[model samples]
Target: MSAPDTNLEKQERRHKPSMIALRLVIAFAVLALVGFVALQMLGSGDPIAEELETGSAPSAAVD
Candidate 1:
């Protein structure tokens, strides 16, 4: 038996709705991660200065 040659028509590929939604979700997740990192970098203060201002040892108990 011989297989039929069904490659006569070249079909145009279209983006699936689920694929588009997945891409959008991935893009938003990346953006969110970048924003979180940016906020962390921008909001971080000097740890030594904070410790000095607090005037307490790191392991000291506070009453």
Candidate 2:
């Protein structure tokens, strides 16, 4: 078991998001879906959809 050591090619990350950003995205998506479902179940005509659709949740972008 040996790795290739002959003229290794350089690999660059281009336009890639960070791990924290990815986790935030997934967490937000799940939370939005869960909130929407909960809203539908309550039958109070709440405006949870507004928050989800308007991207009001806390999130940040990493460089």
Candidate 3:
């Protein structure tokens, strides 16, 4: 019984490192996805479209 328990514990220990690495990878992936979505939401727009709708171009000359 003790021998079997030790074997089980060793297997669990072997799996722990991989599990931690997998969790870290998943966390980074989620973080990257969130950042990408935020950037898209904040930056999504066509300046040309806005200018077309407003029917104006900003003057480059400064008084």
Candidate 4:
């Protein structure tokens, strides 16, 4: 058996606010962009009415 060396050290982790803020901003922007594109694809009409007009049952529940 060998003697253990006494060179142990502890590290303190630090958080960077600027990087976190940038990542959050990017995530929100991407989500908003995807949401906008989805809405555009759905078009500017009553979705259920459109589906009914096309002779298919509305896939979503009506309020």
TM-score of 1: 0.49
TM-score of each: 0.49, 0.43, 0.62, 0.47
Candidate 1 lDDT tens digits, 1-63: 765654434221244666778999999999999999998888568676678878866665669
Error of 3 at 24 (Å): 0.3
lDDT comparison, 1 vs 2, better candidate: 1
For model 4, the stretches where C-alpha displacement exceeds 4 angstroms are 1-15, 46-63
Error (Å) of candidate 1 at residue 31 is: 0.2
Residues 1-63, model 4: lDDT tens digits? 864754334211234566688899999999999999999897768877677778898676789
Model 3: per-residue lDDT, tens digit, 1-63? 455455877898899999999999999999999999999887558776667778998545568
> Model 1, which residues run further than 4 Å from truth?
1-15, 45-63
Per-candidate RMSD, Å: 5.8, 17.1, 6.4, 11.1
Score residue 22 of candidate 3 by CA lDDT.
Answer: 97
lDDT (0-100) at residue 8 of candidate 4? 32
For candidate 4, what is the lDDT?
A: 0.75
Candidate 1 clash pair list = none
Q: On residues 1-63, what C-alpha lDDT tens digit does candidate 2 reach at each position?
A: 776654333322332456568899999999999999998787755456656767796354557
